[model samples]
Target: MNFNIEPISTQIEEALQQKIDTKTKPLGSLGKLETIALKIGKIQDTLSPALNKPAILVCAADHGITQEGISPFPQEVTFQMVMNFLGGGAAINVFTQQNNIELVLADTGVNFDFEKHPSLLDYKIAKGTKNFASEAAMTIAQCEQAMQNGAAITEKLHANGTNIIGFGEMGIGNTTAAAALLTAYTNIDAKDAAGAGTGLDEKGIAHKAEVIAKAIAKQGIPNSPLEILATYGGFEIATICGAMLKAAELKMIVMVDGFIVTAAFLAASKINVTIADYALFCHKSNEKGHALMLDHLNAEPILDLGMRLGEGTGNAVAYPVIKSAVQFLNNMSSFADAGVATEK
Candidate 1:
């Protein structure tokens, strides 16, 4: 599917900056909050921009590369975690509840057959993706179908008055899939792209890196961004990528979570560079490749609390701060309104 994600217009930048500067604070005392304020203002094309009906799209899937023993956790954990999410016992659920943000979960391609759950969107493409080490993870048709499903989900969220959303994932060995995509897109070596997913020791991390190397060698190089995603991307990743692009196309604020989510954004940004204009990097993942991806994208994440959980927990945790940015932008007093002296 094609997305016409235009670059955020700079028509309102000066007005937004002026509005922010006239607030009752130092020239830049809000620090990153000020930057966020300006970004949101421009994204909305209004100085009084408001974030409404915020939601987090949590996608679940399983990776066949778990066959390589790259991750410490078994593939069953992916299915189990989806059930945990449904039961509202997962970290993503807790934070979303605490922050009063909606958490939307989808079964992208988990291996297990889930009985009908009211809250879970059944967008499963297949049982799960094929192992990339031996062959392509998905056919182009399957990849595109996942992408369309994600886009449709995001469009529904938009239709429901949701203007901002976060992307998240739950798939075993997805870090390996993310690492493989990182190497392909940024041309970074696999050693730097691999990381300890699900608490791998140093030795396991080394083995994971080797697996990345072998996969890259086997796949050769991707001819296109979609090729890269189909070659090594997870169903969750491709779905998230589609949602992100559609969000940008709709001019909705996109909250990008940690490494896997960022990898999806990376591919989406590759597809449409302007998607970065509407994204907020929610947090810095503890994974090495996450930092490298952030650097490559030139994005400054909102939080860096050493978080590595992949269920969009970073998005839920950092969401309050984003709300504060918008709240201050709309409600904070100016020096004149407060009858206060300006900094001299």
Candidate 2:
């Protein structure tokens, strides 16, 4: 729980900027790639930085609010998708494979009892969270335990020399929980926070909004990030929050996926404002309120492919771009080395 995350130092900014500017190209020809290079350099505290052992941790869980019929998909889909992920049939699997990013899956609190697989991590805090529509989604102890499990996973990866970690989540009806958490943290209206999750129709979205509003009324506003998480967060979301905090504490590059993952980051940022300093917002999800959430964080996503699928697909797709950024920084020649004349 004690991440002890520190703010990214600015002392190296001048040196990093100079190195980037001296590249054998126009001052700003690389655009966002240049910014990314500078960021990685600062994160590594070196003029030349390298990305190694890139991995994405996908956390799976089930939401008790699925009982409220917020999503068009059945609760069974949560488990089914976990199976899909294991079977290499999911989008995340394909993208991670295509990009050569290691994919790690965790069963934080899926309702089903999964048979052990070599690739799947077993850290189920419970079968699933309690119905937040009726009460707190998770007990305080469960939330804390979920977060600790997340931190432990990140610690293991960091110890193994994995310095760039991305987070993704899978949980049926989790968007309802995400909406409620967003409303609580940002005071965004319930209707605005609600979205057509998993192909919900307008009427279903309306009803989902009503359910979220009622849950908010019942739980009232939470006093802190921990309280909000315990009151409305899914197991996967809470775990992602803990993982993100640990990644930032370790000064690793944290690649964040879509809506649900962003909700986790929102909570993590509230707990430790410096977490965002080490984060890379991968893309803008088409899901409702996602753009607003990115704006809230003042984050510029690397892509806007209208992607809303979770399970770290965005991070996997964007990993090559992140790698390219680091590559140019370490390999590209300076103007003098390239025998290029400066613009007169």
Candidate 3:
């Protein structure tokens, strides 16, 4: 999929930083908040940036790789958890509601048919992706369709006045897919990228690693990121990847959730490297390989609460801090405005 994502113009960085440094608080006292404010300023290309209609798009799907017994949770949980999200019972639901962020659920490719929910977007791509361990997860056409669906939904949200979008996902056996995609994007070893997804034990982690390795060997990664995504990414991941690309193109501040979402970010960045200009690495997941992946991008997460729940909880939980960043930038008085003298 093609996106005209441009780099955030840095022409105003000096002025933005000056505005931040002149705050009544000691220079750099706000630390990352200062950095976040400057980024928002550069992204909107304005000194006064306001977050409007913040939202989290949670894409739910299932993975046929569960056939290999990769996750402790049954594949049916994908359907169940999407139900929880719709019924306002999931952790993501709780966090988004508490933070007053709009929760947008999409049935990207769950195996089971869902009853029509007013909130869930119907963009299911087939029943779900095929078994990547034994075959391609999705055809190139399916992958393209998934990305198009994602970009379309994001555009709709943008049209609706949403300017801050975060991505979340629910899918059994997707961490393995993420591991495979991580390896494809960064050449990280499967053994290292593999993790204890859904509470996999030491033995299960090793087995998951083996399956990732086998899948890579059997279906050799293609040259293009899209082909690699089709070979290994789940419907939800490709959807989120597409959404992120569009969010950057629309100049929205993108909040990246846990490991799985970050893998999608990796794909979006590979497609358009400038997309990183609009992203805030929301949190560092406690899951194995996530830290390594974040380090690969030199990303300093806004929070590290040892969370690996994956359903965009990180974004919802950390958004207040993001708002705080913007709040201080907009509300805090400058030294001169406060009539406070600084030492020479």
Candidate 4:
């Protein structure tokens, strides 16, 4: 469980800024792109930073909360969507293919078993988490296993020279778990954290909120990240937390997806605050609690396409923008190199 993530040093910030400012453009005109370039440079600890073998890891699982009828989609949909991801039919598949980002799928804890597939990593920790309404979502052992598996996956990718990763998840009723985690981490009311996930209607969302509230009351407020995750997190969430921490430890660019992925990062940040240093929030999801969650982290997302669908689609969609940021920093000519007159 020891991530060993270290804070990114600020020693290079000034130098990075100088290099960016010398670009043949009005200072700060590039806005957030400039910020992203600086961040990538800081992460790589170099003036010239490159994204290598960028890939998106979509971890799918089932939630015990799904049995409580939180989502309009059936629990079977979780496994079905995993199949879609494998079949290259999901939105994430389309976007990743469109952008040429490698797609990695993991069965962290889906309810169904599958035949061996080359693209799917079989790291199933359990069929699914236990119902938090009646018991802890996952035993401590399961939580640790899921996290370790996630970290191991990232380590393998890093070994393969993959320096940038996007984290995403699939789980029926996962929003309930995310709401519970958000409430625990930010003290946001369960009602506010609850959202219309997977086409939940108003009544379903209200019921979801009540379910989360009861789970919180039963579990009491968790004192630590591990405790919170064990109490309310889905297998995919725990795994993403581990992946994110390991990515930071390896100084990889972590492109975080929407609400559920962000919730995992919230827990990871609590465990090791430096994880945020390696993360680039890809977009502000249209999910109700997402904006609040982003505000909680003081994160500014690069896109606002009103996207709420998961499966790492947001990360894949935003990859070009992120790449552009790094490209302009490393490839754009400086005023001196371009023979452009500096403002007097």
TM-score of each: 0.99, 0.98, 0.99, 0.98
Q: What is the C-alpha lDDT of each candidate?
A: 0.93, 0.92, 0.93, 0.92
Lowest lDDT 10-mer window, candidate 3? 113-122
Model 3 per-residue lDDT at 174: 91
Residue ranges of candidate 4 with Cα displaced over 4 Å: none
Q: After superposing candidate 2 on the true structure, give the runs of residues whose Cα lies further than 4 Å from its correct spot.
A: none
How do the residues 114-223 of candidate 1 rate in per-residue lDDT, one tens digit apiece?
A: 99989999999988899999999999899999999999999999999999999889999999999999999999999999998888999999999998899889888878
Misplaced by over 4 Å in model 1 are none
- Tens-digit lDDT track for model 4 on 22-108? 999999999999999999999998999999999999999998887787888889999998998888898998999999899999999
Q: How many clashes in each structure?
A: 0, 0, 0, 0
Off by over 4 Å in 3: none
Write one digit per residue (lDDT tens) for candidate 2, span 314-340: 999999999999999889999999998
lDDT of 2: 0.92
Residue 155 in model 2: shift from native, Å?
Answer: 0.7
Quote model 2's TM-score: 0.98
Candidate 2, residue 319: the lDDT equals 90
